[model samples]
Structure formats: C-alpha cells, structure tokens
Target: MSSNDYPLTTFLADHSIRPIFRLPVFEDWLFWLADRTGIQALFKCAPAHYSYSPGTIRRCTRHGIHFELDISTYHGWMIYYRRSGNRRVSDLVNRGDTVMDVGANIGEVTLLCAQKTGPDGLVIAFEPNPATFAQLSKMLALNPGLNCVLVNQALGSMTGPVTMVQPDNRNPGTCTIASSTTPGKALSANIPLTTLDQYIEEHPISRLNLIKLDVEGYELNVLQGAEKTISRYRPVLVIELVDSHQKRHGHSAADIVKFVLQHDYRVTDFSGQTPFGIHDHFEDCSLDITCVPNECVSR
Candidate 1:
C-alpha cells in the first residue's frame, strides 16, 4: 500500500492484515498481543510517509478555504479536524479588523481570518518551518483576494536564531521552538525569531484587533515578546494552552492566567463570559483560551 493514500485509504489498507492476524482461534492471542504491545495506538502515530509524496488539495466548506495536505500524516488529520469543527475563531473577528496568526501552520486559520477581515482589513501570518511555510505559500496563491502578509519567521522573546525540534518529520504542526519540550530524539533546525514589538517597529500598524496563537507550548515566550503590542492595542487573544506542553517548555497555566489578568484581560472560552476556571487545572488544562481585553468586553 502506498503511503501517499488519503487518510481513510491508508487506514483501510493498514488494517487489511487484521483478518489474517486473527485467524480462527487466535482471536484471544491477537487481543493479548495488541494489549501487551499497544500496537493499535502507536500505528497511527508512526511516520505517515516514508518518502516524498504529493499532498491532496481539499476545500474546507466551513471556513471557505482550500488546503493541500497529505492525509496519511498527523498534520493532515488536524487539517481535517479543523475543517469539520466549529469556526469559533471566525466569529470573534469582524470586517476590516487587523489580525495576526502566530504559528500559522499551513495558513488554514489565517485564510479564515483573512476572509472575515475582508479586503479593507489585513492579516499577518507567521510560520517558521520551512517545509510547512512552502506549503502555506502555495495555499496563499489560490486566494489572491485576501489582504495578507506571510512572515517566514518564528516569534519569541527576542530577535535571534531559535532552535526548533520536530519529532515527526511529516507533521510540521509538531515542530516547536521550545527546547524544553523537545523529544529525546528529533530533527533540529535553526529558524529566525523576532518579537512582536520589533515587527511593529519595522512595519507600524495603527491598530491590531486580534491575534490567534498556536505555537505548541511556547505561547508565554511569544506573549512576552509581544508585550508592547499587547499593551498598546489590547487585541483579543486566542491561545492554546496545554499543561503537558507548558510544563515541558518551562511555563504554567497559572503563569498565563496571571499575565492576562495583569494586562486587564479576561480569559474565557469562545462562549462569552464563560471563564476558563471551570475547566482550568494547573496539571492538565489543555484547551483554547480566549482573552478579550476589558475594553472590548465593555463594547
């Protein structure tokens, strides 16, 4: 079976050997084997592609964006999941609003934000992984109507070269600049990093309305780097905070919550007024937290 097959196809092919493996009275033995080795779960997590394979182009009806992805890999599964899921991010944005997508993997959400912002608005997307950035650039070509700027660099607390670790070569979403969370064995690369303050200084913007960040567990560093920008505009923030990832990266959920509180921003889910505390656990909080400044909440 080819590794380039769509996720569904690959799934069917991989499990095709199950019948042979469970011959006649060997069903119990098969079960025992699976239980002892954890073969079922690990199979999906394994490298999806062993060689270069072309990605399939698919349209996301929910957000009205097209993406090219190799469905056999984890990255493609995420794209599929994001496509079918509710578009809460789009709802938070408005026409003519300036938006930034930090850690814009493949530009799926960035395209959605661009559509919501319209031609009068601007969407700045940052993606540091070279392979993923190349794919994002290709996807952007299909949507020329969007007023967007693509930055091929990572954002952190400073402007310099940051080491990135990707345990899965085929899944660029797992590529992270946070060294503390890096797997014991992984491929490493040096990418350019810049602060949001430095970015604004170089290309000044009158206002920044919103920012959607999904940079693994390095959210604190990115936020620290954007202190000036956050203080000035107080843009609504959509950030993913995973306790496991945060711990690996030397940050905590409390740290993030405190930072938001100090900046006069309330951390809630996309549903208005539903504070994060309901699901907040210092040890296992893994959800997208929406931070809306008090000014916007009043309006």
Candidate 2:
C-alpha cells in the first residue's frame, strides 16, 4: 500500500477501533469520577496526544473556516485534539493579509490563514515531504475557495536541491532537511530547495504580514534565507525552537536570540504580554515564541 493511502488511519476510520481502554462509556465514567474527586487535574498533566481516524474535519461557522485534520500522525493528532489550528495563528493573522506557513503540515495553519485573510488575501504554505505534501494537498482540496497556495519545496539559506529525511512510522511531521554531518535512516532525496528571499523575488508580494515557521530545528537556515524579506516587510514571526532539535544543527536558543536582535526584533510569549530574552534558561525544552519587530524587550 502506498504511503499516501494513509493505511493506519484509514483502517481505524473504517473499523472504528475501540479497545477496552478506549470504550467511551467507561472512559467517560472514569473522567466524571475523577472530576468529582478533584483529581482531574492529574489527568490533564501531559496527557498523551489523542488520535482519531484520518477523516476528522472541523468546521468553525463563526469564523467561516473549515479544514481537514491529519489525525493519522502524532503531531497532527495533538493539534486536532487541541482544536487550535496551528496555535496563536488565529490571533496574529488578519483580513487581507499576506502570510506564509513555512512548515505547513497538512495545511491546518494554511486553511486558517486563508479563512482569516478572506478572498482578497494570499497565503503560501510550504511542505517538502512528498507523502505529507500529498496529505496537505488533499486537505486543501477538501476545503475549496480559500485564497491559499501550496509549495512543494523546502526553504532554507540556499537555493539548491536537498534530500528530505523522514523518520519511520506514524509521525510524518518530523520530516526535516538532512545535513551531511547529521546521520539519518530514511532518505527522501532530490527535493527542490530554495530561499524565501529567492521565492519572494520570483513571486513578489506587496505586503507580508505574518510568517509561521515550525521546521523542527533548521530554523536558523530558514531565518537566514528570510532575512531580506523580514527586513523588507517587518512581518510578525511565530517560530518554534526546540533545544534538542537545535542541537542537531550545532546551535542553541541563544543563537536564535542573537539573530532576533540583529533583525531588530523582540521575543515574546504567545500572549504577547510577557517578553523574555535568550539565556541559559529553557535548555532541553521545546519553546514557541513570537518575534515582533520594533519592540524594546528586556534582555
């Protein structure tokens, strides 16, 4: 069976698999009992990401947005379980804005941005892995009339073809650009790689409002490629920086903070209320930060 067939999720969807632990009545009863006992908070702590069949699509009538969720994979399942399409994107994007989703897995953020941007706006989503790209394309097709474009190329500091390394199993979102010094198992090669600067120069946009990047760890390469564009447009950036992931590329959060400082930007939490700086803290942790321009944040 082809990877695009989405075998596991397809099977679950058709069979409606429910083991004893997943039986709704018993699970719901347990939750109710726990809530009554004031111990539900324990259940809430680091709750394992929930998974559903591949066919879960959520529609928000109030926001006039709807999109297919990639419930087959771990990250996709968690995002769908959270019901927040691409975290904080709903807050940053606005009507008629030009936005970019650098590592758009299954087009969750892409569709949300398209809905928020309305008919007059434009959203470009980039996903390099072919299997995941197929899923993203399928999601886009399921939700029509959205002003969005899908790119099957990886964005980085240079313009050339690069191999995409994807790990085995159900987690498709872990695909990343493979480096020479970095060892990997699965090999998906010959993917077209380009810089955001070059892409923008070729496909020019008058205004860029926001950029959402979740490239696993190669955030610096992407940011370097987008330096010219960010300097030119000064768009609000939402980037994910995981310490373990960054270590693979021989860098740290402090390195990213230095880049932010060079770009005249400040790092703030998702609420945008608390501003922080790069330091020895937050080591060995996954961090999601919003990089805003022209703000003087305490270092």
Candidate 3:
C-alpha cells in the first residue's frame, strides 16, 4: 500500500489529522466524506499579536464603524463579526434607546448598538480589563459621532474592588472576575465593581431599552445586582452563555434561564431557533439568547 491507495486520507494521516478523523463518531466519519476530498493551502493572513497597541486602526466594512482594537488581530475579527450575533444587537436596539453593554470587549458590539441607537441614544459600555479598556477607549474616541460612555469596571452583585483573571494572554476577551482555579492565570488585575441597580439609582436613566451582557461567567451575578433595574425597565436582555465560563462561577445555562423565567421573561435563541418554555430544559440552550419581557413579546 502507498499514498496512491488513498491520497487524501494518507496525506491527512501523515500530517497527524488522521487521529482526529478516527474519533468514534459517525458524524466525524461523514464529515470528511460529505465534503469534497480536496485541500488547498490558503495564505495565513491573520495578524499575530498578543495585545493591542497604538497605531492599529480598523474600519469595519460590514457596519462601517472604526475600531481601534484591544486585540490586535483586527483583520480576522472584523470579518468574523460580519456574520456573528454582533449584528443581532442592531435588530434589538432602536434610535434614541439606551443600552448597557457589559463586557464590551473593545466595543465590538457596543458600536453596533450605538449605530442603531443614534446620536441621541447612549450606550454605557463596561470592560474590566485595563489593557482592553484602553483599546476600547481609543476605538470609541475614533468614533466621536457614536454616543457611548465606556466604564472601566466589573458589574456584579456588589460595588467594590474585584479581582479579574486572564486565563490566556493570547485571548484577552476571556478575562473574567470569576475565580479561576485552573493554572496559567498568572495575569490578573484589581478593578472596581458596581451593580447596575445601584448605578441606575444614582445616575438615573430615564429609559433603558436594552442590556447586552457578555461578562463571561458572571452573568448571573450581574443579573442579581440589576434585579431592581430589570424589574423597572424590563429592557431586552442579550446574553452570551458558555458552560465552561459559567462553571467557574458555579452556575449553568439552566440557572440563568430560570432567573429569566422567574422574572417573567422569555428566551429566544439569538438566531431564533430554540425556545424556552415552562418545561425548562436548558441543557442545550443556544450560545446567545435574546430575552424579552412577556409583555413585550409579540405573538
């Protein structure tokens, strides 16, 4: 037997991909076969940078918004957002609406909401990582037309100094206030923390139309702290849930869904696929869920 026997599999096996192909799953078997058996080496054009720095500016072609990125890989990320749920934020936001973007992560989705909200509207964006916050500040500065107030702090159930851990240097967006028992979290910083309810009580937002949360695994805590605010405004909730991220905070998708249900809100997968009912089987909840108050939900 030689490479001519099975050129594709033999080449993939020689390059060590054969191990992945051998996984005990019919899906894996059909995956390589279902797709055309071909391989072409495309140019590796993605940028290589561990953190954002000055002099890096990207104008998103999709949304036409400028982003001074915190993560220097702007070329790839800017394109990635074109198809991701970031655009969904635009659908849920409206002109003159106020939005709170937790874990804004360099204002990726914040700018989109700002575009939908218009200049009269306001977007209060929060990012706890100091380095990332600096990039976000620069990006917002680049777009002065967008009315956004960037906050450099974590939103939780209380207001105090909180410890944030960066699980990976290459991935700054994964930083979270949740305790990381895993190793390689040598990078960390102490940042201020505040609750949405308390902040609104003092700052006094007359109308909050949306609250988009991407706080890694601290979504439940933020919700708890904003209970009063949610009850009052009942703004549309856009949340991103990752099982691994939540497990760090001792929570799960079900817990978050339960909280939303208890508050009389219904969950719709951001893509409008899954529906959360009283049955409450959230084991397969979508990564991004749009939560709407029962009163606001359309038939």
Candidate 4:
C-alpha cells in the first residue's frame, strides 16, 4: 500500500522497526513518502520550496511571533512559549530593551526576540554551527534590514579556538564542545570562541535588558564568560538548566543555580515571585530562569 494510504505509526509498526529508530526514521520517511504520494497536497502544502533554506517558518496565532525552525521537535517548544500566558519576556521587551540570545540555533528565538524588542532595540545572536549559521543567515535575509546582529561564534569562559562537534547535517543544533556526550561518535571541527565581555567591550553596548542562555549544557561556562558584563549591566538572565546535558558538560543544575545566585540574582522559578521572596515550585528541566538584578527589582 502507498504511504499516503496509511498513517506514519502504522507504517513503522508494519515494518517491525526498533522503538528508538522508529520515530526519527518514520518522520524522515513520512516526509519523503508524503511528497511522493501527493499526500503533501492534502496538508495544504506546496512543493518543498527552498525560499531561504530547507526549514520552515510558522507564525504563532497566540503571540503573533514567527518561529524559524527545521525539525518538528522545536515546534512544540515554540507553541508552549507562545501560549504560556506568562508574558514576562514580551512585557519587558515592549519597554525599549536590547537582548542577547546565546546559542541561537538557526535564529528562531533570535527572530522572536528581535520582533519583541522592536526596531529601536538590538538583538545580538550568537550561533556556532556553520551549517546552522548559514541557515540563520538565509532566514534573516528574508526580513530585510532587521536590527539583529548575527555572530557566527560560540561563547565560552575564555576567548580562543575550540573544537565544535557537528553531529548530523540535518541536526546541526546538537553541535557541542564536549566530545564524550556527542551522539554517534560524530566528527568535530575547530571554531573560534569568544566571551560576551570581550564582545561588549569591543562593540560598546550601553545597556543589556535581557539575555537568553541555551548553550546545550554549557550555560554555566557562558555565564562565567559574561561575569564582567553581568556585574556591570545586571540584565535579566533566562537560562536553560537541563541536568543531563549539564552532566555531559562536567557541570550540574546546582552549579547553574549557585552561579546565578552569586551574582545577587534570585531564582524565582518560571512564575513570578512576590516581593517577600516566596518562590513558586517549577519543575527543574530546561526552564527560562529569570535573573532580575537586586537593584532593578528593589527600586
């Protein structure tokens, strides 16, 4: 039977594939089969048009923000952020502020941040992976002359050359410096790394309102690299603290919490906290930990 005649799950089950390979393999197969069987048309799809690159940009109805992503895994995350009802970022962004998006994979969050910050504000996005950077460049080109600066370099504790592991061509987001945790014994390439402090010093940024840190498990290192900047600017830090990814990078969730806390920023979970310092219990995974400077909130 043709792939269009059956569901994706049915095709995988009929083939008797292993569980781990079933999802990704079926997804890849379904995309191809749907194209071949004319099922793509049923989904209101056009021929795979390479407008900017191979990825798609879907606009969210809830938030009126656009997400430029390649894989389906990110779609769910975008939807969650759009419909979260907690408009902390959106609110802060409306007041004429600049944001730094570290590890901006293909500029999805970067675009969102830029849109929120508006034309007067700036968005400094950093992406290390060469392939992903190329895609990000193409995607940014679609929006002629945005106030976003795309930097093709990784952030770290120190500024110098470092090895970057690129896992799969289709999945360039998995690229990291840590070799042990990389999937499938992937080949690595050497890339230059820089610290936020150095960049700010060279570029002369007046103010930093928000900073989003999602460097796989290397959030702490990126934070360390920005110690001077953090101390000087005291911007709100939204970091992703995944325990598993931290372990691979020779760190832990507690380490991230401690580091941010040391900067006089309290961890008030995902939900906003009261002035009395009572925190809401948010599950610890990859979360948007907001670090408001003591001075910013106290005043």
Off by over 4 Å in 4: 1-91, 166-170, 184-188, 273-284
- Candidates' lDDT values, in order? 0.74, 0.73, 0.73, 0.66
**Clash pairs for candidate 3:** none
lDDT of 2 at 269: 69
- Measured with C-alpha atoms, the lDDT of residue 208 in candidate 3 is 93
Writing each residue's lDDT as its tens digit, candidate 1 over 199-251 gives 99999998899999888888888999999999999899998878777777888
lDDT of 3 by residue, 216-244 (tens): 78999999999999999999999996766
Q: Best candidate per lDDT, number? A: 1
TM-score of model 2 relative to the true fold?
A: 0.78
* lDDT comparison, 1 vs 2, better candidate: 1
lDDT of 4 by residue, 12-119 (tens): 434344232324464345447655865542221221222124444443333454334443333323342232333455555643588998887767667666777777
Backbone clash pairs for candidate 1 read none
